[model samples]
Target: MRFLQNLLSFKQPSVMRRIDIALIVAVIPHLPYLSGFILAFLFVSVIVIIYIKKVSKSLVNTFMVIGLLLIFISFYGELNYAGISRFSVFISLISAMLIYVVMLQRLSGRVNFYLLFSPALLLILSFFFYNTIPMLLYMIFAIFTFSTMLLWSVMEVNLGIVLKKSLSLFLLSLPIVLILFLLFPRVSFERASYGFTNDQMMRTSHDGTMSIGSDALLVPSQRIVMEILFDKKIPPASKLYFRGSTLYSKKAGVWKQIPQKMLHFKALQKRGEKTSYKVTLYPTFKKYIYTLDYSQRALEASKITDDHILLADKNTEKVKHYKATSYLDYINAEKLSAIKRESALDFNATDYPQLYTLAKALQDTSTNKSLLNLITYFKQSQLIYSLKPEIDENSPEESFLFKYKKGYCVHYASTFTLLSRALGIPSRVVTGYKSNREYVYKNYLIVRESDAHAWVELYLDGAWKRYDPTAYATSSDLLPKENQFLNDLSINYLYLKHIIENWVLEYTRDKQLNILKKLLEDSMFAFTFTFYVLSFIAIVLLAGLYFRRDKQVHPTQKIIDKLLKKLNKRGYKKDKDEDINTFLTAIDLAQIQEINTLYHKIRYARSSSTDEVKKLNKLIKGISSKNPKYP
Candidate 1:
């Protein structure tokens, strides 16, 4: 019973508080990606740790119970989503045990050896979740804190000295770390994507299908979806229709993409000036790749479908970068194949009779006039645009056109395509993203989930032309106008994310090979430049050595050295090769004995509450020849 009491009452060492702080800092980088269960646990755990002593024991117990429940819930949730993998389970168990030890520290104040390694593990695991410049910087800071704990345990130096040495060690090792990173054999992205979160499979926007009038769906997210950099100035927001996928078949108020085996790769006729750009896409774990309107050709990493949709050969859940050339004004095809025409025109008139009659009534002498009249009809409908449109799902198109008269982009696109088919004008729905008025990042456009949109493509005058029906609606629902300053910050973050993603997160063997090939092409020039840089660095270092001053000893050590010489001059002098402690012991002078002890304490202790120099001065003034106490 006494042993139990002693164990529970044991206090933590000085490094424990810093360890807690480092763990908290490590969790910040994951806040944007973590699930609510994990975030809640972290938030509550932080509170318990911060106010552990201030709060009563009952409150601490309550917090502990809640944190444990959350951990169990999160563990089970991860297992279900990630499936039965032994490695995953083992890592999860290790993480749980670490957290449990940390919690016990708050409750019992017992020193935990397990926590000595926890901060470093947290930083390593954070790499698997996010790889960005800001995250890398925070990890470095956390590393310094971890280094302090290790240095303190072994060296037992002063606090300032410990910090300085930690910094020097990290700086000395940085070059080797970079060399290993550059030379390491990286696994292919498809085989070794970092995470196992199931959210990648569930795209929050542009899922290649639409059923707008169904029960209320997931709330829209404002998180960034893609960041695009154009070689030229970005086009107006009205012209930024970055297509991701195309949908054709429809039944029971749902529009879906039906793969056309007969419609093979076909070239798009370029109309206006071609613009080239790079796109950095966030993970959707889907095959569809986003491209600007009327992509000129297949991207290097993907294939172009008949509808000009870019399709990656395989799915991935990592941030992807690709270059594409596109013309905002272009003809999808001069001649539509029979298979595509059938796909575009196949719609049941009986299912939406009201919309079909409306389509026939709006027909005119020419296809152009018919399309114009259809646009005017929509403009006059006085329909409001909303995310959650109150309409019947059974006959969504008919209900939207004749009764409810209100819906968002998906509803407008679906209704228009059905009506155009009814009027003998072949049409298909395109699902993608569009940037409205907002601040651009330099020349790049940062597209978000809020930019997800749907539009229609009509066969007009021997070409499939773009038509957005939502443009005619009265005030569509949109995210509120964000502050310009906040938007600029977001844009800045994307700039850094892109910079790091290409160099580190997405660095592959193919990129390295390409770099080496370029280097070989310019071998002579590269060798000359390298020689000049090295010569310059050597000169600067030599110049520094020529003029730099010698180093000095510590202030406290100087004072003690002065006192030891004075003591030697008096009759208390020493033997040959005698240490300071041995000389003090042999003389047995009680007055100055404390001076020797204080100096060594200053040199050896890990941390000191009072100034070692101040204590030494106090002892010196009274015990030395100048003191009034001896007189």
Candidate 2:
């Protein structure tokens, strides 16, 4: 029983408990928006503080400093993150700080009006990231919780009365909220409503850099990257490679593009049937465009580089709708430039002496060939393909080549490029998605982040050729055993997501304007205009009715409230729990003790005579408007 009481925070002040409830409700909506680490930290911190009963100020201060330092370090690390991403994180951190302060039991009794609204700001911030129907409903509930508690704290009312009043307030204002939403001007924001809704939604996978051997589990994202509409029958599964970027420079087990110099507007040589398609890319917070391998032409490209990578003028903070013609099989850079060749072949022999020696050992003596031998070696390497590969920091290629013989696409691609460069082949790493599901939707294809892959592009003989060592990986189990029920659920979810994105979240300013125009043109608009006029009349009548019987309340009470409001405006306000005499003296208004005495006497010392009333009124009126005046 004691544990249950503590768990429910029953010992806390009633107002404080209400505030806690409001704070928790406001924070719950941000779960999908916040990272797992921050969520876990917040959970443990709040639980520990709540259950410990007594928290030292020093301990709270220490944790506060630690949490702030963590936030500062994170902000410093992700300086290049999108502005919206940074702003959301800043708001989230501030919310955490407020939660800490509220849970500290420091203000359990003396409730401040500002304390109630602090959590309200969190609900507003959350809507900026996501406004799904469920989220909208949750936010509505959070608003009600805040309203009910705030009214209870200020008024001397029963729980039933408080709840009724709160509901009445919401019900009364909902019509106005609807009217505003219908007529208010809307604007486009959140080209990405969420950062990966940063790095958690999508990933750093499509970002310029790709690392081979990090000791982290490789979990795939189901977030749709792009939906493509093929002009004809979609290409074969083996040919559905949507290229993002070409990486040549390898440093510290990471592959990255060489210099911006490697990027150019020169076109690739055409050699096969071209498939034209329109790409509707979602927000990646990046500037690169994805297209089929060896694009013939990208209509929206600022530059179609020789590496077959497309560059856009601005980051994909907004949806990109463009068309491109591409060839699944094509020869690239038949006459590879000397500079490009050097970059592709650039590698430190000292770093991978083992890989270099192995490359030489694989050279066939009779045929004097290395390419076929390399292919055969990979086929016979018996390398298992698993997303959860063991880390090999010092020598990733060496470990994969001889010791562990286990890795995913990145490991295989990175190692293959290194070995190719060692064998005097001008080769580079390619990062993109190999979308091969039989999924289709009205002549369009949805490419998911799970299809993200890395392969090799080597300038051999006369042109660049494609090679995916992952295809030869002996054991590949990147997906789980087939679960028909689970797969059906996933498909339905994706379909619903697509529908919401098109009809609601992605409903743009133009769509809103079009809707407004249609409504205005309709005959029912006459009723809408009448309703607007009636709403105005209703507001004015309500205001008049409220003040109609103000004479019933004594003038003394009104004067006291007016004075309190003035004092509050000037930052000389008194606490609700403080006595008038104490509050007045604390603000150095001790010279006006007569007002406090008269206030008490007027209420407690029976009916005042007319003369006494006039004298008290005159003395109170004697106080100056600018500064206090004594009578």
lDDT of 1 by residue, 507-590 (tens): 778776565666678888669856765565555545444433233255576776666666665655666788777877666567
lDDT of 2 by residue, 276-377 (tens): 987768778787888888775545446766676787877777566677888776767657677778889897888888897888787665322787898889
Please report how far candidate 1 places residue 10 from its true position, in Å: 21
- Which residue runs of candidate 2 sit more than 4 Å off their true CA positions? 1-202, 215-217, 229-232, 262-265, 278-282, 298-302, 317-323, 348-350, 364-368, 438-444, 477-479, 503-631
Q: Which candidate number has the best TM-score?
A: 1
Candidate 2 has an lDDT of: 0.70
Error of 2 at 277 (Å): 3.8
Residue pairs clashing in model 1 are: none
lDDT of 2 at 600: 63
